[model samples]
Target: MPKSLHPDICDKLRFSKLYEKYAQTLSNILLYKYGDILNPSDKVQEAFIKLWENCTKVKPEAVKTYLYTTANNMMLNEVKHQNVKFKYQQIKPKDYTNESPEFVMRKKEFSNRFEQVLSKLKEEERVAFLMSKVDGKTHKEIAETLGITKKVAEHRIYAAMKYLKNNLEELNKK
Candidate 1:
């Protein structure tokens, strides 16, 4: 199989014609929407590749709309995510580190609490959370680096936060 035709669906694509007509339209929409942020051309090509991979699943009547929607959604999400990450990175601290006895004691206590809570997490969850928060990566980037879905990356992060919150609260009471 050339991958255009799956066992259940017919291959209705005229590859050159379809590519020529839809490619530029998709690229233009993404570029206009996400300009000066990331490369829309690459994102368009990626969306087309995804479409081609599942060509059999797409009906000829809806392929254009499907491609456009997928590309647009992807680009918009990427743009929003980039903005959030930029804002997060811009947060600066007044002091680089605390050196006083009281500050050092609090830091050690927080570290111990963090380590205790971290030990309770599943190995994969801990690694994903650390890679995302400590190392600083967006969910999509973390997903790509770990070969996992963005949803899974998000879930792991959420679980880690919940665990840390609970553990830290307990530590505070102690």
Candidate 2:
């Protein structure tokens, strides 16, 4: 067992000291396990908050277990909520009526062009763009999902849009 799992000499765990010691490690563990689905850092912070709230009940030696359990439960709830949301969205009908044939044709052409341009972008940019535009994820959500900063996610999405716009303009001329 790791020494970190054991209690220190002091019976009561200090929030600031405990956070300083374990925050990054806990975040890394959650990220490694659940990065694709949710924001690990947010979950880690939530776990710590829960720990702080229940500090008196938790044994110092069991703090690590408590954190992991809290984080896992929070993630599970998020997954369940996402699943319900997905199911509800799946049941919603999409409307395509009241459109001219020419408009539909142009839309199809634009979509094809968009796909082509997106494929040509760098992998990171393409991913960010797809997550933001196609998947309808916000910049922060994309950053969390990709384990990147929000600014980086925004930049990648912007670059992708610029690339697509330039390519689409060139395509129009051809």
Candidate 3:
């Protein structure tokens, strides 16, 4: 008999069954880590989506690990975003009037350029970059969560930062 290249869960029926079997466990894991602030059910769905997207790469036995890692990463990102939003909300609207027209236009331009540069990053680089910058994770933590080598994660984050810096500076000079 030949060994299968993909996990059994890569099949639709098997994947659905796996989801049914592990969905509660995934939700509970998220709840334990974050209480209700992170939306465990929603994170569970997102983890399953990721699992399906990477179905061929995942081994059947490691499903739990994969789900747990992704769920934790997702929660961390959400927490960062929530903190930023809360801080922004606390600022008085009077701060908006302090910007000169020139500053406003430049700020808008820079934001557009930043989005474009970010969009240009490869998926791997973007993931590593956001994990490092947004979630404030170390290379080792990023690698363990992403299931990549620490060296690879470090390289990806470096490449992403280099790309963003070079592109944004060049764009601003124009």
Candidate 4:
């Protein structure tokens, strides 16, 4: 037996009306069910787009279910990605524990904080600073690699360092 009372949702008029009727409600449901970790509005839009693409295939009755399932999967994929990221980033403590646990904990905290600040830097600044500090590149080398002027490269490195210094002032003092 057919699931929906209405026919297929291929007609543009029917699809538009269906979208208007259910879009906000679906967004609310996704946010409530899945939390705000991912943007529910974007997920809802994607789901609707999928339905529209497969409108000829999906019966009008199943549109709601199809949308929710697609959006839910998308949200779950993002959550899964985050979990995998944390899993790989998980710190493994040394079995010997030569350093005190307190020291290790403090080190990890500082490392995480430093990473946060570093990630917040602008792309140009971060790239210049990393090349200088991590790769031991000179300002001229950085300029050649980035195709920027030496002064611009030096300025980016300085700016990045200033930002890091300001944000990590407490750590620098200690």
The top-ranked prediction according to lDDT is: 4
Tell me the number of clashing residue pairs for each predicted model: 0, 0, 0, 0
Ranking by lDDT: 4, 3, 2, 1
Tens digit of lDDT per residue, candidate 4, span 61-134? Answer: 67777887899898888788878888889767657768899998898898888978987898778877877886
Clashing pairs in 1: none
Error of 2 at 71 (Å): 0.6
Query: In terms of lDDT, which candidate is stronger, 1 or 4?
Result: 4
TM-score of each: 0.43, 0.44, 0.48, 0.46
lDDT of 1 by residue, 1-174 (tens): 244333422344564567787776567545534563577887788777878888778766666777788887888878888889998798664665549878887888988877777878876677677767765768997676456899999999889778887768753465
The sequence of per-residue lDDT tens digits that candidate 2 reaches over residues 1-174 is 455554442334467777887676566555544454588789989998888778777777787778878997888888888888997686545656689989888888988877667668988787677667755779997787566999999999999888887788854465
Candidate 1 lDDT (Cα, 0 to 1): 0.71
Q: Global lDDT of each model?
A: 0.71, 0.75, 0.79, 0.80
CA deviation > 4 Å runs, candidate 3: 1-98, 170-174
lDDT of 1 at 113: 75
| Model 4 TM-score on a 0 to 1 scale | 0.46
Which run of 10 residues does model 1 get worst, by summed lDDT?
Answer: 1-10
